[model samples]
Target: MGKKINKSSQNGYHHNNHFSNPRSKTKSTIVGGKYIYHGEVTVEELAGALNISSADILKYLLLNKGFYNINSTLDDEIIGEICLNYGFDFEKEDIVEADDFEHYKIEDKAEDLIERAPVVTIMGHVDHGKTTLIDTIRNSNIAAKEAGAITQEIGAYQKTINGKKITFIDTPGHEAFSAMRQRGAQVTDIVVLVVAADDGIMPQTVEAINHAKAANVPIIVAINKIDKPGANIDKVMSSLSKYDLLPEEWGGDTIVKPISAKQNIGVDELLENVLLVAEMRELKANPKRPASGTVIEASLDKKVGSKATLLIQNGTLHVGDYLVIGTCYCKVRRMTNEFNKPVNAATPSTPVSVTGIDGIPQAGDQFYCFHSEKEARAIALKRAQKLVNKQAKNEGVSILNLHDKLESGEITILNLIVKADTNGSLEAACSQLKKLQVDTVQLKIIHSAIGDVNEGDVILASASQAIIVAFNVHENSLALAKAKELNVEIRNYDIIYNMTEEITEAMKGHLKPTFIDVTYGHAEVLQLFKASKVGIICGSRVTDGTIKRTSKVKVYRKNNVIFEGNLASLKRGKDDVMSVKEGFECGIVIDGFNHDGDIEIGDIIESWGQEVEKK
Candidate 1:
């Protein structure tokens, strides 16, 4: 047997090697805030050249520009940003030709790289039970726990199937799946398209297929709701054939599994098929090198500050190692697996949530390790300077120019401004709208807030050239006139799904869907309170069905709906209530109705919302 080296001894060997072989020094100029750089510099090289810490360069990117850490290929835009942020006037670097980047390329050694688990993404239309299926496989209640019973965020989870590991990325919708692709991260190895047996192919189902096809990934159809009374497997298969996903039974290569997420049927067979596809791909990576991977999701935690969920595609990530992610740098102080269990290191295809980062890195940002904290900080500082310069030059990039860019095919970005009546509505609307992005075409939300359409919103939309979308909110006369004068497009919706369909249509440059409102409840106004933050509080008794505080409401004056908004606050006396059953008295506040004379007692209030009948 060969002699084994202790962990400390191995680390010492690497440390000695790093100090002995010095990188070639290149002369550069820093003239009046302008820095000169050579072709295709990695984060480490850039940090070394600037005599700054790589972590500093990354911090600059995240705090100032909202960019990822340093595992970056410095582009012209980024180069400009770095120069500005570092207090440099400009960067005088030779334009890097494709072939000139040879020195930066990593030669793949077949022997060193070993096979890794395949990353699969499940996608489908709203209410198709994508999360329900995941819940069934994991034996967890994820779908039931999410707000609105809809998976609104992207999460990565791992499972063991017949002793083989598989990584699954649960994306919100087709838009989020395509958004990752648009960022140039082809992370998914396979796409599992879940379709309801009864509902067959819906608008989002088609969009999911298009996104999967665009990525050139294999798709497995999961016909869910098989146990439902209206389920028809043959009908689902027929609808799928038109999209080129021919069922295996029909002499095609596509694998179709009929499953009831609620019943947990045929899930074992689905796992076997996934493993089969994964084996064919021969997915592999090098785990001995410095860790490098993409950000799956990121958010700020009240306790931990900024936290990010990272999918390590290659190499082993260890605690205390300084990492550069999309322009921000952090030392890995803590790392946890999907189950929140502490782990010292992570290997290829592993999903880990790590803290100790300076700021929240954007999703899809690539991360890599650095040898020293000094190098990381320098690079981060230089990048921060670049961002400062870029910001000063452009002021703020608006989405309003998106239409012209799309028409010219110069850039495939859909910039939007979203307005809603409540914070929850705003969050849900943005979450669903992001799923429409595919290929080069991406959806970028310029601004999202809770309120009625105002002149400020119009101005921002005009500057950004973004389409204004209103959900459970209305454009006032001033905002409407301003929008007209600026030739800004304003779209309105009372239902969340309808707005999603409209945005998808706009992205595809197709016809918009027509919607019809259906009232579910009504109440009679008994009294009004003038002194309240919720505009005017209308004390009323539920006259029909039940009135929910979160439901959309419309004021009816003599059989015609006059004012429409949200039931901002609902209360039975001083105690807040979610709903009031028929014959129960409750006080209600309209979100946008602040005028004293706008609402009066004895007016009938109807709670209503819209739904899409069909495309």
Candidate 2:
């Protein structure tokens, strides 16, 4: 074993015999009072430069930093410290790694740039005629095919207007699909915010405006339902002005068009305006370069395997091109247009349904084409490893670590999802949470609604890195399980004071974990009976998981929690039982609920338990 040297006293080794001696055949040289090293230096190369044996350097590092082999490359910091010990400054040749193909910055010459169609995204509240507008423009009946006439997923389509092509991305309008809407905004160059003339501006309409603003894109308001009897264009325009989207007629740059999507009234003018804006922006891309763009959407088909919809932003994409998308690599076997027509190649702003992806790439993930399969595969493997490492490092932000994260500049915004038993409570909770913002961090409520926390909430929280605050409302079984799987934090609180106080303390880095409610199962009341001995009994059918007699029960009427207490009795077919599994009918009685009409049919009875969350 060699003698270990203290890292703090490393400079004292300058006059030692190991470094003072000169070794032949060394590549390093000292000039202008600095030791110049070329490229990355290995342990053996460093030892040779110091005129010392490689074993001494390895032993010293093993005793201090970590073990290293003779051939292992030394980091710049280690090389610098070692050079300082030899009475010289250090300088290494700058070595650049392989070009980051995924994030490669392409600067196309003006001569090589050609005009490309503008990518437009349609966003608005539900039932605002957004899909109808797209259907009218594209001459497709996609709205009729959707379940409940609501677009559940993102759909990309291409339409030609006056000899010019335009790409349209139709995003879901429901509040639950906020993540999808956000993704749509990011990849769009222009946003067509459709506001229902009858409904004016709604919650999702405001959300769409904010998303578009955050994306720093131009907005064109399409006031739909003008042909309806209740249409009010002026009211809608005035509402838009409140969001700082003033119409051109009102001395602002925003273009407002009155269109009846169902009647096809003023639809032609909307397309005209889209083209006009595209021309003004001078959208251009070089189609001669290798293809690179974002994945609009992806899915797994039972017959075709993994298929993805790619929006080629620049360069031309061919059928046989090798692509590395996120962590998946694939050789494009086939490509189809939005209408499912076979296409040989796609240019900028073209949306194509591509097949042969090894794995499903997430929506909004960027993809780049490579010349060789080996290079694409290697890049994909490295990306997959990086993703695994990142996931391991991300523990999912929670209130307990909010202050620490803010102080460390890890995050500047705290996103929250608020759920409450009633509209009043939801409003109050959101207000209090917003007021908890400090100077260093901002609090944004991405979604707020009245109901038990559900799977949709957990999914949104996971996507947005947000925490769910349940006020007087608990998460359902499915939501609780999904939250754990996604590492989403759902904080439950019944008292407004405690909720605000604890959040304040958390913002100040003083909060601690307490007992949290755990949901066991839920059952729906099928019938109500007036029991002579029990006062009132609920004939219920277990809908999910298992309900036990010892678990505490809460009465939920229309997604609102109304009562909470221990169960009076649990019976099956007039016989007492300890537990009832899912899909089984049983009799339930609340200990404190005595009125015969208190528990009504169609109401939900939730069984829950509590456990302490240790620090």
Each model's backbone clash number? 54, 0
lDDT, residue 274, model 2: 95
lDDT of 1 by residue, 427-520 (tens): 8999998877645677877667788887756655554456788999999999888776656667888998888765665555565346688777
In model 2, which residue pairs have backbone atoms overlapping below 3 Å? none
lDDT for each residue of candidate 2 in 1-615, tens digit (9 for 90 to 100): 011112232222121111112123344667787877754578778887677787778777767766455655676878887778667788874422221344335566677688999999998888898898998998889899989998888889999899999999997743323354333324688999999998899866776775566446799999999998898999888888977899999999999999999999999999999999999999998787667788878999999999999999887889888888878888899999987999999989999999998899888677877655766677687677556544534566787777877787767778788889887888888888877755666788777777899876776676667788998988999998978776788988988889888777877888766889888899999988886877888889999998977677889998999998677778999777778999999998886685867888899999988755732
Report model 2's TM-score to 2 decimal places: 0.64
| Per-prediction TM-score to the true structure, in the order listed | 0.53, 0.64
Model 1 weakest 10-residue run by lDDT:
1-10
Task: Write down the RMSD of all candidates, one decimal each.
Answer: 18.9, 19.1
RMSD of 2: 19.1
